[model samples]
Target: MKFTPVSGSSALIGAVLALVSSTSNAADLAAAEARARGHIAAESARTMHDAQHSYAARDVIIDDDGTEHVRFDRQYKGLRVIGGDLVVHSHADGRFKGNSQTLAKSLRLSTQHKIKASEARAAAVAAHGGEAQKVSEKVIYARGDSPVLAWEVRVNKAQADGTPSELHVIVDAASGAVLESWDDIHTAAANGTGTGYFSGNVALTTDLVSGTYYLRDPSRGNTYTTNMSNGTTGNGTVFTDADNVWANGLLSNTATIGVDAQYGTAVTWDYYKNVHGRNGIANNGVGAYNRVHYSSGYNNAYWSDTCFCMTYGDGDGTTFNPFDSLDVAGHEMTHGVTSRTANLTYSGQSGGLNEATSDIFGTMVEYYAANANDAPDYKIGEKLYKSGTGALRYMYSPNLDGSSADCYYSTIANLDVHYSSGVANHFFFLLAEGTAGAGMPTSKTCITGNKLKATGTASLTGIGRSPAAKIWYRALTVYMTSSTTFKGARTATLKAATDLYGTGSTQYNAVAAAWSAVLVN
Candidate 1:
């Protein structure tokens, strides 16, 4: 998550200066500095006029190198803008060099508020199909050429999946039209334990504070677990014990869920460090904490970037149990990984890729753990849905669940990200195990439900799971971007495979064939 300034070499400075001319005069520079120093309202009008852009300064980061990155949130006619944030780069001399923006165009828009704030809130709640627990309003520049002024209505409530949902519903202020809406709760699902629901009869790492042992892992970045007492939010109370022994096979014991959460956290940390050389979720050697026993009758788990923590829910205990399984933990933690890296936007094709990244890594983490109780497979949340021997999603044949797509199609982007992720999941499975069913339990199918016959022409030989996972990790960290599409994913993975195993090696060929088999091309 660290944004290191590019070295201010002559060549780099020249390149940057080429893209941006010095638009601000000395007075403008002073105003910008004043704005950066918290005189935002005082200098807002003058700064926007001088810069010829309606952007409000959000952050000013002065790097160790003589570079200043002034982050700005765009505004249109005195309203805040979303997806229109940009960072203006300048030399130590305050010479504006260039800027980076998520916005695609200028923020000129009709500021007439045809739709009232209450109407926007009602529309957002109606879209959510629930009572809004909280609502806030702001103006945003919707994506595309000539960004339009829209009301960014933020709604927070409990979703059907047992996770608290933060939804951003963008309503056009001038036209009273719904521009876009997306869920902000990035749910996958998490972990610890004396006896995990999945990892049975296991020992837990604890920290002795005063006379009690706290549910903290001393070996893994001091990662710990807390009991939410069946509530929905907040950092719950940390489990403590007079004796070192934690859970005792009692489902009613809140500490039992804590055990599964803590153990899963430890295993996920090990999986990243040992398998991928990643330090932690952010790769900054810092461990993320966990909240267990979240909400009564809850049945989902989620990782929150805002909280820098993961939350697990205690299921209804009949069809589902506590969301503290190993693979679930891995899956949720990988969401943190995706947030740090690529940061794939949580909608459309990129969202599918984002979800798939977590599923792929989560499965690998389970395999890497090699825990006998939870045998590693291409199934996600399998332990959570053991009552019917079903899973949240299946990587080998995603369509087996009757929701996820097994292969890509022209309208794949229209599907829910959880379902669209099937294409990439199937691709990863094919890349690791091959289309011939070698070392695999079964063969795969295309989107058209065509049973893939393993003939010599269409058969493929895999290059092993370890290499496949490494290539994917490399692609995610090095090649992918925020707006990457399925086509871009193909190119990114191809480049990663080429970088790792050469241009025409078996690994590279397998990656290409796998994507092709999944209809990505």
Candidate 2:
């Protein structure tokens, strides 16, 4: 291991050159950058092999194409070492970086590590609960680097009657590094208690039998699955010990699966199928899966494509069950639908649209799931008592929250994805529900311009959630893409409506008017 200091310009040159230079010292140059990046600080590396392997690691590999491969703990977490020096950046966050300079820095990793997969796995297992067994080894051979070994360990524990709890582990092939791990710990007491349905193959099953609720990932090969039926709420909701899912009593279900979650899942499932005719999240008839009772006191829910499942948190106990709202479930599950279909990159306008898409569909799902138990509402997070006041989001009127946008503006990009989502949410509301003036069905009035109106205006005011959802579903699943913006969404939905009903039909005209009302067109 050697160190060299270069001018700032030279550092940039070296970082760039590491990509093009095909010399034997290329690794040295990369290692120099890695050393500079504090990948292997002397203090951390000083006691290597003498006693304990105090491993504080960072990724410092820059490829010839200038793509950076970083393994920083704080940044690029959840990367699994496959073979050789090659570690697989499996998570979506790991694969892409919005900042190129940060990426460039990762590319300059010149240092080589000779870590064995078995050792890394043992360390990881010990760090975790250490309930692992049958640790098998494999080699991770990457091009132009030292080989990395990995271990495929299994956690084969059983319930009282010996029902196997099959847990899987994928460690660094070269150095026993635990890259990823998953296990199903608890089962539900009743089958139907936690069960909800998603479109086509996707389903949200609260394992009342397993005492958990699951968002099934109906994608092929069962990539990302969630197992969270811990005996107590929030007790068991992690796919891996390294995973963090925000769970609390937000939706407020005991060990019993929250009812709103079931409504949301069912509605979202129905919306996609009935409206867009999507077979499921994957559009292949295979359904997605959901799991409840994830982490202890978890407050947020997430749609994980890696597990092909959706997860809900109990919320802050005193507040809400994140899953107890139809809109929330629709929102999370829509994320999965977006991932499988458009694979929207969550940044810029695309990111905003992606977030808005969730809000839009979630709202649509709410209306679709018009259960007598949970009346359909235009408000988001209404069921979950987040702020102890209103829903998590609002579509008809975004400015209702000081945080969200009421109308489109250039600065919307700077807003959080959720807040910026207001634009799209508003657009959807206006499109289907129309400008609320007179004769609207809304409990609340939408004030656009100087006009304060109900949800129903003219015959358009009577257009219920079903028709509007149908058109929007078509736009989202079939017409919209990852790059869609607010304006683009308007056009897509209008086109969808026209295609569904004749262009001359009132429905198409209504969609057009709604888009106009929202000022998206």
Candidate 3:
């Protein structure tokens, strides 16, 4: 019942062709992209050789006042440069506000590499014990001071315990050594066949080919669900029905779990599309697919950016339940959201933020759906418990889990990214609901204490959940970098608040107070 240990950066690392597609914001975004492109081209040409550096537009944002921010992925020569991502900022009147990038050094690394692609793949497979599916050279700055020409090798394999793994190994092309490696499986933690057992009776759109209904949503970019047949590999068969109605919420039926997964996927898609204006996971109209009943008794769920899909598992019947619940679905899919925006490195504070982002959005998706069968709450995996009590993690007070920290400390980064997420979770709770109001979720952590204010007040104020969510969404899409830390989050949220509600607004002050309550400052 835990979503720990996997980092999703490698899954999203590559050439990204993200452009805002909403018709309302289309013309404004195009102009913003053009201005930012000119700035990037001028800077690169003036500084690094004639044209050694280039950038591809990823995401664009234009505030109500016409202030704009454009995100880009940097390229050295033809190779994608990891951590060389930058955001182009401009004022409402179109004056440049300079570029915001994490890469501090000049881009002048030699693209030539001594190691052969075969050799790099061999080394990667030897280390991880898997077939080499892909091996490409890239310039990586996320791991070191100077940009490194490294081999991005993806080994197709599963962990020893049968957990599906796409081990992405970064090998130094010069040193022929492993730079870093992480599993690409973004798990939420597990299923059956059949309208959903968990989501209540819901409406669904299916493709009717020759009167046979295919389990696909044509409206939401043909988003579909498949049965994994309890296998650890393959894309599986897409669910089809003789009748338009899929199934009742019955685990005995093979597609019973698929119904829940299908319902969950659609809800998450609607949440992002309507609430945050994200067209899809990548801000394109395309939808990420879902796979349910994965690998017999596999108690987990995950989103794979490489496959652009979500996978679910049936609980072992002891610790967890089928992980096709609404919030869990939203949690896993938000990893895809993080992949597209910010691309937060899956280590240290950045990784914690990545996990926290999923939790925050996942919880919001629950509230957004307002599902009657499943009540909205701050507890993740609350409904997925086999015992039907307790939760995977408590957002109001992370320390309730014994591992997650409710307060930020210098060494908090030493913990797993999942546990380190506690502080941000606490901050978000305070930002959305205030200091544990009567009858609201209570915690035995710092929020209940007087640490939030200098005056030793026991209570902290909150802006409503919707406004808080909007601020976080804006901060994530516009200001956050791959390496943003807790302190950096404070700056980003304040900026987002100012952009949305103005500098001296109540929402702006609430963001500051929430961070202060969590000791981020």
Candidate 4:
């Protein structure tokens, strides 16, 4: 979002002054030259607003020429600014004036720029050692820095028997950068709607399906497996053309991983929209980019602020496909959402809380999607493991999984962020359910002690997950911050519940007892 200063004759002059102000006090010619370039760039956008859907521009910094500038390998085709004007500073030309119009549209700036998403995708695929013509096209949406455009394409290469081979490309529209690709040949034909990327292979009827997902590229073959390793069912790798790669190695082959990834994303989008009235992650009704089969044998998934996209990878086949699970997708994508909003740090106790917040929302999305492929459980990393016998992390008893800590302590930060997340997880469970021991309820329960157990401890039962989740969300958004700790979380939730339900109310008092049971002062 660009911020355009008020425009008038004087405003134009003021913009020029702002441009010149970039380096007025520079002592050296080198510094002056650097500021000149910086001023021009800032001045270029000074009078323009609504660049890339109102992405505000601030803290303009200019680098000195001869400062060893680095450029991306792919060349820029053109500059397209949406919702505002793009002011170009022509180096090779006769005199140009303010708001000048040229005979060459390509040379001049326009309100919005339209590019061939398919063409750019093909170029990126070819750059990555794949044929462009044989690939089928899908969604082409705008993405991160340099105003990138992302396109999906499926490969149509035939084998020796004239059978179609699997391949897919996610190309960058502006620089034609092959951002990522996937491959795994599924026999299912493409479903006609919104590019048919993963719609055919994975069922969306709210039941979760698990299988091996694969991606093919001329460079190499990448495969990943989901939680289902029974060998009878196969997701057939919906993309058939995209590859999965992680920092560790090749992830197991699992079908419907893409569908799972997309499903998780859809659920998250809907949860925020229907539950919180948010349009998308940024609350702008814009779709975010998602990449499945990120790396070979990749054991983890991540949300990248740089690319503004979410990536998933298959897990160890025997344990899980970290990408195919709904909670995992929601967890990673929530990192993106959190970054856009609270921008939580991934370190120390606050970091543990950050991770736990993702788990909280992630698990919520799972239940929201409520697919049959995987039953929604109040656990964070559970579905990623193929064992199916054990959960990755549990909210009720996080320590049971062997990774998470059961209780919060000052030293919680010393534990792995994933493992340390237990404290907050447990806190949330207690907040929602309270302290009840005998029955081992599907959800946790709380025992509220009023007046030293004179009435045999009046146990305040929970009002189910619906209202509980709202309290947690409100606390996270309105009260919690980067420095929030376990105790802070306790206070935040109690405050949120009291604000929403009223003080001394059963809901508010139950929330208070839940925190006390968790040992949060």
Candidate 5:
């Protein structure tokens, strides 16, 4: 091979241009953040925030006409405040328009401690019931009926089956009481498709370093897949090849699985950027890495915010195959998106919305791929099973899963988030495909105390998949909060439709009717 080098002047010009571009982005973010801080200062003077609270900008969204939305995290008296995050919306000229927040009141709690840090750690350890591995502790003001002093404890442990038990336990700093605890590890399991190991033979953009081609996507945020070698811990090696070509579409080559993950991640990246104008998973033009062959006979896949990456499992072969399907990739990556945007609390109605958001986007990614070998459908994790019909959940009619609710119910919040997600899934399906499409019920009957039983002549008319997805994405990023409910989702999506289309437009009406069909009102 022969190569020609650019002249010194050309190379210097290229370097200077790259430097200017990088500096411009940083300067833009800094200016917007300054404007947000000014707005926040005005609000604090007006008592919307406490004088002791400090705001740090995490994200910035600039509209076509220059309107800005700045997302911020809060701290008080040198202690982090959980659930104290908020978004500030401003006019093109930096005038504060309004804000999106769940903090109904300003922080007024005293930052005093009655219990020792060791005692709080002990309480967290006892509540989690795992080996005492104290990762870190932050004295945080946790949100509840009111903000209270607490210790946000991190614990590291593993379940017997190799699943992570990285627990985030909240212990009351004043009483040493275990207030709340949740696993940081979120699992999305059981589904994917087609010939050539889930995704068909496809093109990939890889990294060529020192005469070796590696499965790293340089185009899409540098997302690369690694080989775990079936180990239970740590990021494994990045797959490399002398020739750019990869596996022969079988398990005989581990890179086959890597191909599936790589393709999935790439397709998902393109879907979000092209469809919604999102730059990347975190909307920062950076990619999340992937790990294939995680643990021996593991049957699950997950996205860890702490690591900012996607991890896939090689199934036991009885229930699922390797979880590297395109939808699986989309689903897992959406979890990261959810964490970065709304940071939806992973419990109750919001948790279900979180899961459903992944399912909805994953299905969209599958369709976006338009793979000839793999057919598209509105089923969650269906492709993982030996039997094609064994989907983890159904969207058009979630009740077919036996546990998921097809309509909103009073106790829906008490169900597991995976099952409760049925309501949103059903709503999205009706909004996109309506009650009379492929694999859909011609008449969807629901009376779970929602008054109107939408069926027969009252069935909803779908606007289209593109509009429906755009509305949902708008709602998710621009309107929904950490603790949004089904009713709130209805409102958010309605507003989103109005913003995208117009008030009382067909798309807006369809969004309303779809929510009504699912009994979210």
Candidate 6:
């Protein structure tokens, strides 16, 4: 994704380049910024009746052709509007061209509150199926034929399954109607240690803050780990010790699991930096923190974009060990990366791509680490199984798991994202390793119960992991967009392969063949 500098516009090019260079800070888009504000004011007058409705510039991008795109965050009555964001496109002469908005209609709503804030909080808690531990309310523009005055109530509590909860509920301020609700916790029902369940015996990196050493890596953006102390929520205590050495084989010694988590985090960090040129999860050069032993007998781990952190569970300690295995950590952390980048929504086919992206990188990270005890394989959560004989997902043959779809179909979009992820997962395996019987892994078969074969008469040849991973990473970061579908993914990967290996090259052909093999065409 290289952009050529426009000749005679070195100053403007430098400004645009600076804006696109770092994801850490907002770009100082001076020229575009000024035009964007005026555009917003004019649009606000036409769309929103009240003077209270306004917009603040969130991002500005100036294309090489002299077009400017300004993204704005909307506010109503000085309060943030949840889904009122829009993007304004302008020409170089500061002339308004067009705008894209999430809102379906104009913002005109009654500001008078018929429902008390306390009542709205209670309604939110009731909708969340739990007692409210904490609740916050704000005015928001609720989407409909006409935007309506709504109280956006956020409730935090424990779920029925003992998982920590963060639910957002929208209640109509005048009618006290529950307009919408959503859970913030992203859990994938599935870590660490003095002796990690999979990493075997390992040494850990620590930060010596004061006289005590803590489970913090000073090298990787000061990445740190903490013990959740078997609770579901809140920032856990940072693991500290008089001696730098921590974690033993005993499951009782939770610090041992922290060792596995910390090690996994380090390896994942290294994989992104060394392979994909990503500095960290958000490409901000700042590391994310980890929390282990979340909740008693918790069976799932999750990544929270709100906190910019990852959480691991101890499992039931029977059916599963800790959820801090290297691949698991990679999987979870990749979720954060996806959120920061192509943020594929967590449902339907896009969600499947989201999960497959994580799974793909998770496998790559595992192989990159090359840990002897946890031999790398195209299997997700292979180490988390209590029996230690089965895997949660099989990339070589997704149907072996009995839930994941091995090939694409019209109905594949209807399956759960985790299950639908099989399509891309299998495509990736085929792209990297070719067919199972054709000289890659053993005992691999296609969704049709036949030997996996390439599309058309072209015989599939292995392109190896490095090229495949690079292609996928490039597609993910450069070509993929928020609403990219499987078909769009095919286009993205093809473009990526072309960029990396050139058009009509062996790698490019392999990418096309792989997608066809998975029935993505």
lDDT of 5 by residue, 407-496 (tens): 887778887788888889989998998778666556474665742233334566787789999999988887777767788899889978
Per residue, candidate 3 scores C-alpha lDDT tens digits across 1-521 of 11112122332122333365664366677677777766665566332323555556777877666677888776666677767778888865758766656676777668888888888899898887979876455555454667789988878887544567776688888888987666667665322111122887888878999888999999998899998888867898999999788788777887778888888888999999898888888878898898888887676788787788998888765666677889889998899999888988776788789889999999999999998999898988888875566777788888767677787777777777888888889889989888766557654335334322222245776787899999999889888877788988899999889988999999999898888777777
Provide the lDDT at 303 for model 4: 60
Q: lDDT of candidate 5? A: 0.76
CA lDDT, every prediction?
A: 0.70, 0.48, 0.76, 0.48, 0.76, 0.72
> What are the per-residue Cα lDDT tens digits for candidate 4 across 1-521?
11243322321222222221122222332232334333333544442322222111211112232211110001112222221222222121222222211111211222232436667655655655445654334332222122334455555454332223445566654455665443332111101111011212333222222543232221111112223232212232234322232112223334455555555666677787778655566644455655665444445555655445565554434434444466776777677665544334455566677788888888878778766655677755555555445555778766666556656555666786677777677666656565453343443332333211111233546555667888887666545543466776777777668767888887787776666654455
lDDT of 2 by residue, 424-490 (tens): 6766676566555344434233334522122323323536567777777656544554446677677
Candidate 3's displacement at residue 254, Å, is 2.3
Q: Candidate 6 lDDT, tens digit per residue, 1-521?
A: 01122222221122232233242234446667667666666665543424556555544545555766665556665566665655567876878876645465666555677888888888877766666545455576544445677777767776656767666678888877887654556665452112225577776778897799988888898899989898765889999989887867677787878888889899999999888767788766789999998888887778787787889988876777888888889998998887665555565677789889999999999999889989898988878867767777888777777778877777676787888888899889988887743445642334443322212333456688899999998777655644467887998899779867899999999899888777777
RMSD of each: 8.8, 17.4, 6.1, 19.3, 7.8, 7.8
Q: Show how many residue pairs clash in every candidate, following the order shown.
A: 10, 100, 12, 67, 1, 10
Q: Where is the poorest 10-residue window by lDDT in model 2?
A: 186-195
Q: Give the TM-score of candidate 2.
A: 0.51
Worst 10 residues of 6 by lDDT: 1-10
In model 1, state the lDDT of residue 135: 45
- In candidate 1, what are the lDDT values of residues 6-66, reduced to their tens digit? 2223211211211111233444444444434232233334333222234434333343444
lDDT of 6: 0.72
> Ten consecutive residues with minimal summed lDDT in candidate 4?
67-76
